[model samples]
Target: MHIRPEQAGDSHPIAELTRRAFARAKHSDGTEQDIIDRLRKRGKLTCSLVACLGTEIIGHIAFSPVCIIGAHNQHPQWYGLGPVSVIPAQQRRGIGKTLITQGLATLEKTGTAGGCVVLGDPGYYQQFGFMPSPNLTYPHAPAQYFMVRSFDSNIPAGIVRYDAAFDT
Candidate 1:
């Protein structure tokens, strides 16, 4: 699959792909599509991307700014990675992984100081250097499932808050 930044024209197919991908997921809120829509409408899709075979989009991933509480009132340049989805028929073909690898690599290039966080399975995310961070927390998230991959030695310690777009 070829991975590329999501263009505006890809929104509808991506929404459909996301809806279908998570339709039967264990922890799906059944609103993954809405979340993506909200995020995009708010201009919070920091690095949205798509995994495709030729012109057909098969996978999608998104990143958005996150706030680190108690960062001493300084600007927190953290990002949250989530709602990654690959079409059910395309699952396990490494499409999701490819999208993640590409997205995170792109995040690294933004000179992000607070790095990235994801609420996902440890088994899968660990390979990408994401580890459970005791110092950083996402409210109500299982400690082990909420992970971070800091870009620096001094990892920020605080509550991680996703954008208001996630409020719904």
Candidate 2:
């Protein structure tokens, strides 16, 4: 399997993969594709990566800017990682992991020390250093579903907000 930056042509395949991956979930809201569309329109999709086996896109991941505001009115650096999807047929093959690791490494190389936030299973994300943020909260989601991983130790704590597109 090869991991590479997603190109323009990968959109359709990626969408299909996302749909298939989330179709059977109890919480399928059809919002994953919407989020990707909005992020693309806003040009805030920092790093979109895909894991491929030959010409097929088996997995995908995206990172976009997020902000954390502290009680003292301090706004620290951060980004949100989300909507990670692996084609249902390929779920256990580590494609999601490859996409995430590659995407994060690319973000770090670009001087993004703001860290990353994700709404996901702690058991899975913990493997990548993500943990619940004691200093932050997401009103709409359970606290346990929200997590943060600091890429730099100096980032301040604050309310985490994703781009407006996420609200759609």
Candidate 3:
């Protein structure tokens, strides 16, 4: 299996994969694909990657811009991760982890010091250096679900807001 950046033609299959993966999961809202579509249309899909086994797309992950609003100010440089999906049949094979590792490496290489954030299991994401930021918060979501990881350690704390596309 190999992983690579998603291409234009991969949209349909990736969407289907996302839908199927989340359909019966614990948080199935049936909106992940819509969020992805909106993010792509808005040009906020800063990092979108897919795991391929030959000609099949078995997993996908994306990262888009997020902001933090602190007591003193708001930061708009940070990015957020989300809506990561792996084909149901491909789950438990580490495809999601691989996609995240590669995507984060690419972001760091591009000098994205603002770092990445996500709403996920703390234990799972902590392996990637993601932690709850005392200075940051996502008021709309559960406290534990909002987490961040700074690539440069210079990003300030504040309310983390994902791109508008995520509202879909």
Evaluate all candidate structures by whole-model CA lDDT and list the values in order: 0.88, 0.80, 0.84
Clashes (N, CA, C under 3 Å) per candidate: 0, 2, 1
lDDT of 3 at 157: 58
User: After superposition, which runs of candidate 3 have C-alpha atoms over 4 Å from their true positions?
Assistant: 71-76
Supply candidate 1's per-residue lDDT for 67: 86
> Any residue pairs clashing in model 1, and if so which?
none
**lDDT of model 2, residue 131:** 83
lDDT of 2 by residue, 121-164 (tens): 88888888878877866667899988877777654656777888
Model 1 TM-score (2 dp): 0.95
**Which runs of model 1 end up more than 4 angstroms from their true locations?**
73-76
- Candidate 3 lDDT tens digits, 1-168: 898998989889989999999997886689998899899989989989999999999999988888665536544377888789998888888888898899889888887346888898887898888888777788987888778888878558567778899775
> Estimated TM-score per prediction?
0.95, 0.91, 0.93
| Prediction RMSDs, each to the true structure | 1.3, 1.7, 1.7
Candidate 2: list runs displaced more than 4 Å.
70-76
Top-scoring candidate (lDDT): 1
Cα miss at 105, model 2 (Å)?
Answer: 1.4
Positional deviation of residue 161's Cα in model 3 after best superposition, in angstroms = 1.0
- lDDT for position 156 in model 1: 82
Sort order, TM-score high to low:
1, 3, 2
